[model samples]
Target: MEKKIVISDEQLQFLSKYLNKKFPNLSPQVKIELMDHLICGFEVKGGDDFYQYLSNEENFIKGFINNEVKNVKKTYGKQTWRQFFSFFTSRELLPITILTLFIIFLISKSISNKNAWLIFVVSTHLIMIVSAIFGMINKKPLRKLDEVKYLGAEIWLPFLMVTLADNLGFKNWLIQNEFIFTGYWFFTFIYGVSAYIVLRRQKKIILTKYKALLN
Candidate 1:
């Protein structure tokens, strides 16, 4: 026969406060799921009365409290990552785009100086290529469903970097009046289009994962 476990008002209040503080926007469904887990935990502790269990096995109670704290910490960490993903998929690209523009500006200013512009453009391209190669080769597997969005970002970011670098290189070459590179405009157009597509795809994937977790 399975043991029945009851939680005290104090314990429930503590959990509620902790959950609310840690997850202010936690959905009611998720709250119920967490409560169910807590009930199972209480049952597994194995005692006729909750207070008796706590008093009789001080070490167990201590361990349980420690575990709960660790769980809360982990939850916060996950939450932080989810928030970061939101920013990364949307606003974080802005800095990279700006950096690419700055590089273009510098290259354009140094256009008359072929040697300097060539060195800068080549160095930037090489770095971007190496980064893309490494990112593709050393990509980690997604451990959680929520991490799928991150994985998708990883998959697309290299392509974005490459496109940005290619565009910048073409711009630099054009400024140098070398061979009249029109590919830069094409690459720039592609970069913007791809960025929008990737952002939307990532947003949908993340939101789906978030909804699944709620259930």
Candidate 2:
């Protein structure tokens, strides 16, 4: 039978501090993930002394951490896109999806084009603000859901699109052309909902994964 390695609380704290020095802006979730990985590596490498093992393999460990960071960033992007597309294609969500489209269509039709565009853009910004606030007000000791860090694309992509549209004079073009404006409005709403879904799903996963640690 393989011997089990038990990591003590003090040792865990040291690991945490070491990671902070290594990655000043590391997310709580990623910090925890890397800490677990380091402990497992220590066990497999026949280490009775964690600090000594880390010192002996300092260069290798740094390279490994760097690779893991890249892998995590890539995986996060892939998971987000997969979740966004899955939301649109799910059979169970089809009816609600249709209803949402209908509501957005009605909203676009009933309001003046310029007003509708303003509302869509403003609401998107408001959602971003609320999401940031929500992350800050979390009472958990370790806040895994840092909105700026995790949802960088979701929060800023729409704003960037709006900026690009204005710079390209698409805003005036969109408002002047009712058909195009309606389509743009629908796209904005759908994108916002998809972002919300991604945020909720991510928060759930992080909370579930770190439930014991949080408590």
Best by lDDT: 2
- What candidate 2 gets wrong by more than 4 Å, as runs, is 1-63, 133-148, 151-153
The window of 10 residues in a row where model 1 has the poorest summed lDDT is 136-145
Give one digit per residue, the lDDT tens place, for model 1 in 1-215. 77566677787786667656654544444556665666567777756565454345446434544555455445434543454344337676557655655565555455564554455445434434543443222213222322332322422433454456457665444545532332342233234334344444444544555564445
Q: Cα lDDT for residue 118, model 1? A: 57
CA lDDT, every model vs. true structure? 0.47, 0.66
| TM-score for each of the candidates | 0.29, 0.64
Residue lDDT tens for model 2, 33-143 = 767777888877775788997677678657765676666566556765676566579998767767866776677678887787787788668767765655322535444
Report, for all candidates in order, the number of backbone clashes.
0, 0
Over 4 Å off, model 1? 1-3, 22-32, 47-215
Clashes of 1: 0
